[model samples]
Target chain A: MNEIKIFSPATVANVSCGFDVMGFCLDSVGDEMVIRKTEKKGIHITHIEGFNLPYETDKNVSGVSALAMYNDLDLDFGFEIEIYKKIKPGSGIGSSAASAVGSVFGMNELLGRPYSKRQLTEFAIKGEALASKCEHADNLAPAMFGGFALVKSVSPLEILEIPSPKELYATIIHPQIEIKTSESRALLPKEVKLEDAITQWANFGSLIHGLHTNNYEIIGKSLKDVIVEPHRSKLIPYFDAVTKAAINAGALGSGISGSGPSIFSLSQGEETAINVKEAIEKTYSKAGIEYDMHVSKINTKGIKILN
Target chain B: MNEIKIFSPATVANVSCGFDVMGFCLDSVGDEMVIRKTEKKGIHITHIEGFNLPYETDKNVSGVSALAMYNDLDLDFGFEIEIYKKIKPGSGIGSSAASAVGSVFGMNELLGRPYSKRQLTEFAIKGEALASKCEHADNLAPAMFGGFALVKSVSPLEILEIPSPKELYATIIHPQIEIKTSESRALLPKEVKLEDAITQWANFGSLIHGLHTNNYEIIGKSLKDVIVEPHRSKLIPYFDAVTKAAINAGALGSGISGSGPSIFSLSQGEETAINVKEAIEKTYSKAGIEYDMHVSKINTKGIKILN
Candidate 1:
């Protein structure tokens, strides 16, 4: 149980209507890691890239997570870790989850891989709560296990794997704008009508059923979020145009990704994915917002050991 | 269109954690009706059995539904319906839905059955709302269409068909106690923490996935309702005993049946179903509540034509 090279995928939490409980992994959107053994008795923050991440253990999300696991497990092993942070931060794409999960995964191997992926995800949430001020594993679960994941319970941290169906493509559009979690969260209303609440639950119920049964048409109809999107879509530039454009381009459905500034459109085929990306970028261009596009398949394997 | 006969089966809404969106049919637990052509050009209801039900057009859930379709569609024929109410009222099962959907289904046949099952369920909701004051087709969806169903969105009324799933048996326990829908609904809280809300969604998501992938274990694991169960369980005399008894009797999972005075247990086989029924009855006996039991396979068909 010495040095280990592993990978943790980036996740899109809230996958349209799944807010806080549903998430899926991306093959093309994630982070990579390399872990090496040292004679020293503790973890060392070796490297970081692709984002201006801090190295001062406290400011380094990945570093702090590795430290937490080491302390919590009471292990006296030495390791140096290098992280390749490919996904951008503050883009509503679960950047913090990538770092925390990546650290836990790499370190778990250095400690004999005693914990399972589910265990690693649990341990990772402890670090995320410190960074996010609330214990949220919506992103972390998918990042650890890949595919479609659900957090059955939180206090004890129950993670359940959702069966992923084929022929699904995800198109992501990063508007190159920053929307902090705090600001994004503030836009939601505290109280909702009982009617709205029931509606949300009903739609959410169908969305889960669709994902479980691989009923794509149902999934398309169910990917609507009334609670947050109405309020938060205002924060993203050309949110409406981007959504309309994605649908026009053959997307089964489109909605704000996670907290948002980053928008995602889901389609049924590869061609639809390509069309959605093109449409999204075009919408952003029309709205005068700079954007980057990525077309990907749903990654079923979340974290993997990369030699 | 010529006169015809249509049947809508009884349904079980809220398959444990699904609440307002997930529902399924119980073939052995349902009702039946027969609609025949008449020269009278109006609506008439008769032949309700097993318990007292309203016969007046406005007061009858089923009768009102038949009238709604007759008025809305402006059909040229009259219908004489004989409802064989097999499932008892106040059983926490979709008793009222059986009537509502049953009427729509029968009338649809008389009008050449132009409306799809989804459309029929929508018409049924018009009747359900008149009785329950909420526009929910959770029960009707499963009733109109066989197997497990979800009413994804109700405005245009989107329906998603989920698998009824094998390796599962339903054991329903009727305590011979009545809990009105309005009284049962009064127990819920106005608001819940985001964390609890997330758990509800998670379990729901897992249940959907379980049904799709035919993962019974995950379905059992996901059988939880944080929002309604906590508040409603207090009304049941031996709530914990019934569930514990059922689980101890080889049941995979168990929970309250919609606005329950009745409890339902999910078991793996015939043996477990028998055991679960005994356990539920025993628990009720210990609590001094009168009861009866029905052990059944998940019914896909709604009401049927006895003739």
Candidate 2:
């Protein structure tokens, strides 16, 4: 297969109680890419569309990730990439992750699937690091492996795939505001009270159990971020109002997605997800903040091939 | 039932990574009690053997817990309890928990079990607080609910019963020394680093997932304690040596049972448990510390009835 077309998924990381270590894939929003084999010996970003992104191989996330994967392989030929970017950069819903995952996934497929999905995640995070300035697998793992992902240990690069409930869906509302990763990170305290840490871990353990058992109430109750959200939410306009509206409209829970500017809620069904979306829209409309929204099923099969 | 004879198991709390929130019941080590319905109007401690403990109802853990349960119920008749304490206090394993759980469990049986295992945990913590000086459900939950238990929250009392792998076993070594709960608690920092908290939650989530799926290797990997052990281990004699011995002998993982002095290790099967026990015995002997040790399977039934 000289040429391949694929759809790469967007992801929500730091999922409420699971800060810096957990994430889930989304189905409705993503980017499409076409990767073609070339005689040249290095990665080439031949075309880009729908987004203002650099065409240089080292500067782009997809190209960087593809290069990371390619450099390890003793291949005779190189690859040219065409990105049809749809997910916006800095949306806090893993926009860069989509592109990073897409290129590696496509290249791996073209090479007749030499590396495992987990290996692909390792490669993707190299590209993810270029954007976040930190090596984190929370977004990359979910985008590559699909469903819910738990980054057990980053040093060892262990990613545990958690099964998503069949009816689970996500509603994302990206308020068009830029919150620099460094700024959001700086707002957090260097040290947290041990009492709060215990509460956070308890909720995190319960959330994992709830996901395993398909208990919606437990999931809802456990979606609390006592550590990061309080400080970071101040950066976004009407954060609390949007979350309260989503919860009142039947979302299982709501929290600032990733580092925020975008908010996310998980609901048990598509109908409730749509309700959550409409509620967020109403709240954002009242707040007079420009926003983009999408309702998506928890994508069980992450990056998909497109003919 | 006019009179009930029961076996309430000892429990190992803070199973490595699950500090302050997780625990598992033990099979071979526990306390026995005989609870009898009496014409008396209040709790009476009639006979005591094997251990010198307070006989007054309010001062005694079992009496306190029984009273806590009794006060909630408008019982026309009071109860008498006989103590056959085998598990020693200040052993780090849940010795007081056995007594507390036994009284309430026997009373619940006599009263036709109005309270669930979860509710029993609530009553048991009332007794546990007398010893620990704080409301912690880690020990009580496992002693009441059986298997492995996750104390999701203290307020509003949520206990999530985790599945124990069939082949799992515990090896416990109790060095005859006193480490006051207050002193042990004082050893902990009021605030912990954010990076350490992330590692802790990641391990916690992985540990819960491992328990659910019966993945022993994953369970072994996830049983890491980065938060509390560093300070607390100083109080225990041969802590590092014993853990090293246990690990070298094929135990999955080891840590301080609750606070200090007593150490526990988990292994995959009976043979490994015995090996771990022998290894710990060797280490403690070399250190010349007077110690008591037991090897037992993970008790799936928390408390049991004896005719």
Candidate 3:
């Protein structure tokens, strides 16, 4: 192989009510990958763009994914990789997933598509596990399947790709403040009582119904996170205010996207998307916090090859 | 109005993870209601079969629903109602819902159909509130809409008739040890930790996904309840054993049906249904408890006016 070209999209993990067990990848933007064949049959990472970070392939996200691919399959193919990063490292927009998935996707192209998409995802998740510090597949799934997904159980292991709903818009607000996923998770209690759990299921069920039947109102009403959001919400300034504004601005639903500092809102159309984006920005402004927000449709396509 | 006939079907509430907020009515097999015009505007009840009781209308389940209709409309129509109680009470098969919905359906026919099905459901839920002492539409929605239903929010009062999934069969096991709905409510905890609640939502979402996509494995895996099932299950003897046996018997999913004494298992076909029934009965027999079981489909039609 002489040259390999690949691209991976940013993913949204733990989409509201799905908690640790769900994710979806977007098509609008993510990290870029450029892999070139080398004389040596080992992975080498050369360039990283868009954020301050290290250049070592071992520490690089793309490098980690490439490493997992090399380690899993006893193959020697020397490749120099360059990463043009758009999504940040810890923005909760699937930074780790982007890198890991990028490497696997790039390698698949270089190896003349030896592994299937599922196989690439498996290796990508391994890289993600090391970087995200959790044995989760929410980000990995969307990176692989490219749409709404559900992780039924982790131990018995099931990942389902739900069809991308019609009239789906993604509105995200990334506050400049940093809240690590580890800290967000640490705040959650070890055990929960029985009553609240029932409500959670009810909400979850309604959300799924909303997705299937295109009942946006039900989805909006049912988007509640009893697990991570309540405790970790304190870490993010004006979390409630931003969500309230999004809902008020006619967003179908809004909640903490992965481990905030980033909040994502779903809207029914472009009009609502813009409205929600403005609402979120205004709310953050009121709270005296600088943030980045984007209003875009749900990415029907996950990753693409650009040669 | 003279010689009016109305019908309401038996309903399945709780739907695995949706404890108190989901329900739908069955078709063909339910309660029958017949109303006749009398000389005076006074109400009289007769022919309460299956349960040994006197025929005073107020104490009757049909009478409760009738009362709501009569009160809500402010109408003066002397009526005689004969209720054919097909679904047995305290069976955890939504017997009360059948009667309640029957009342609304019968009265609507007598009044020349003044109310919509949703309106009748609202009236019917009031009757359920009287019977179950819980403010929920779990049984009523099913009684009105059939198939799968969602009680969107219990407080602000929303009941949604969602899609009834195809290729889904319900296996209900009715153990003849009476535990009232109030008693089940008393057993459950008032509050739950945030995290467990979120898992419930994830399971719930997966359950809906399974229903939407016709994926049985996901439904089975997502049938877990972290809240009410753990605590309230203690009240039902052999609850754990029956659940284990049902799963082992190739049922896709198993859980206590509503506020049981009754356990419900979900499967894709007749073979799984038969196996679940055998497994459940075996457990109950070992526990020395008398019980009955049924393998039924998700009844799509809500209710019908049987001539």
C-alpha RMSD values across all candidates: 3.4, 1.0, 2.8
* TM-score ranking, best first: 2, 3, 1
- Please list the C-alpha lDDT of all candidates, in the order they appear: 0.77, 0.91, 0.75
Per-residue lDDT tens digits for candidate 2, residues A245-300, read 99999999998888888899999999999999998898889887789999999999
Residue A9 local lDDT, model 2: 91
Q: How well is candidate 2 docked (DockQ)?
A: 0.89
Better of 2 and 3 by lDDT: 2
DockQ scores of the candidates: 0.48, 0.89, 0.54
Question: Tens digit of lDDT per residue, candidate 1, span B11-71?
Answer: 6787766777778777676777777777888778756766788778778888778787788
lDDT of 1 by residue, A1-307 (tens): 5667777777788876677777888888778888777888777778887778777765677777777777776545576878788888887778889888988888777767788887777778876776687887888988888888877667788777776778888899888888877898898776554445556666677777767667787778778877678899999988888889888888888888778888888888888899888877766777676777889898888888887
List model 2 lDDT by residue over B1-307, tens digit each.
7999999899999998789999999999999999999987788999878899999999899999999999999878999999999999989889988988999999999988899887887887898788778888888889887899999888899988889999999999999989987788789989999889888999999999999999999899988889999889999988999999999999988998988678999999999999899888877898777889999999998899988
Please give the lDDT score at residue B114 for candidate 2.
97
TM of each candidate vs. truth: 0.88, 0.99, 0.91
Model 1 root mean square deviation, Cα atoms:
3.4
lDDT of 2 at A145: 87
lDDT at position B54, candidate 3 = 45
Off by over 4 Å in 3: A37-39, A112-116, A191-195, A226-230, A282-288, B24-29, B53-56, B180-183, B191-195, B278-287
| lDDT tens per residue, model 3, A106-135 | 778877888887777777766777777666
Clashing pairs in 3: A192-B193, A193-B192, A193-B193, A226-B194, A227-B194, B23-B142, B24-B142, B25-B142, B25-B143, B25-B146
